[model samples]
Target: MPGKFVVSITCAKDDTDKATVGFVVANAAAASDKDTVVFLSTEGTRLSQKGYADDIHEEGFAPLGELMASFAEAGGVIYVCSPCFKKRGLDEDNLVSGAKVVGGAKLVEFMSDGVSSVSY
Candidate 1:
């Protein structure tokens, strides 16, 4: 069976370079036909908000918003941390397309099947 891949992102902005890299990897994994999910926790949950990544164009890379949209369109799952988003006072009604607000248990459930994970 194909392996499952989980990407855990915890950054809030373009300055947090690791988050960008993690998203890139997750996109690749999804494209590779692996079961892929991106867990947005802590500051990473900010990306799930509509327009939050709109102007975030990292040098030498695709725009973060475009990258995220492409990943979701390609059948990758985006799970935003519910508590983190709530703590940051984000608007759930304005979530980006293909994003879901879920608790840690949801993430745990997705990764329970011996999934490979990378954290950023």
Candidate 2:
């Protein structure tokens, strides 16, 4: 089987450029036919909320929400950190499409077979 690619994101707002890039990379990996996942931790969990990323448009790139939606639409899995989400008191019922709240074990399971990972 092809190797899986995992992106561990931990940023928010404009400071989340690297995290955004990590999603983009995961999207690219999926486009290349690899299994890809973006694990949102810390502030990155905010992106999993409805309307949170709506107004965030990065210059020279698609809107953050759009990019994220596209990535998920294209089969990129989005895993939001359970503790992070709870710490921020995010509404679990309002999680965006394609996003799931999971514990660290889920992430570890996905990458257990020598999957490659990049942190943002």
Candidate 3:
């Protein structure tokens, strides 16, 4: 793809709004046909675990879990920070759809091609 987009989210239940809207924007990026990635770091790594986002439903928006699923269905990639995941003791076996645990180098590599990025 000619265009690449990155959405960097560092909060999860600690900030439901950011977590939810991040994926909302990710869905938009995916629909726009950009090579989109939602990088979950810090507290956001918890979201990579199955059922972690199931209960997060922001006001006037779809549930976080559904938003995430649809984002993956739209071909969006979800990158969970390896250090953060291990720091939180999150289970790799329970990773949600489209979610992959990766190191900082991976994120840097993806964005090395002059990609656009947003943070929350």
Candidate 4:
């Protein structure tokens, strides 16, 4: 079975640096053959919107949108927190590629097997 890795991001436009780096790490894990997941919560759920990341470009890194797209293209999963997303009134129809709206139980289930995780 493949090794599992999780990058839990809790901020988006509010903290673009963290969001960018989280996706960067997620991409690395995915490229290294790990089953990578990026859990978006709090303000981070905004990133699931199709055009939300379009203008965020951290210095010395690819644009935020590109990083997210690359991570998904590399087979990484993006888990958007259901409560947080709903609380923010984010558009479900505008969800980006590879993003799934899920509850905490889903997160727990995925990580129950001792999957390694990081938070941003």
- Among these predictions, the greatest lDDT belongs to 4
- Per-model CA lDDT versus the true structure: 0.87, 0.85, 0.94, 0.95
Please provide, for model 1 over 1-120, each residue's C-alpha lDDT reduced to its tens digit, 9 standing for 90 to 100. Answer: 367899999996845567678878988998889889999988898989998888877777788888888888989988999999999999999998788999899989988888899999
lDDT of 2 at 28: 80
- lDDT, residue 51, model 1: 89
Candidate 3 residue-wise lDDT, 20-120, digit = tens:
99999999889989999999999999999999898899999999999999999988999999999999988999999999999999999999989999998
**Candidate 3 has what TM-score?**
0.97
Encode model 2's per-residue lDDT on 1-115: one tens digit a residue.
4679988888878465675677678788888888889999999999899898888776767777888888889888889999999999999999888899999999999989998
Model 1 misplaced stretches (Cα beyond 4 Å): none
List the candidates ranked by lDDT, beginning with the highest: 4, 3, 1, 2
Enumerate residue pairs that collide in model 1: none
- In the range 20-64, model 4's lDDT, one tens digit per residue, is 999999998998899999999999999999999999999999999
What is the TM-score (0 to 1) of candidate 4?
0.97
Clashing pairs in 3: none
- lDDT comparing candidate 1 with the true structure: 0.87
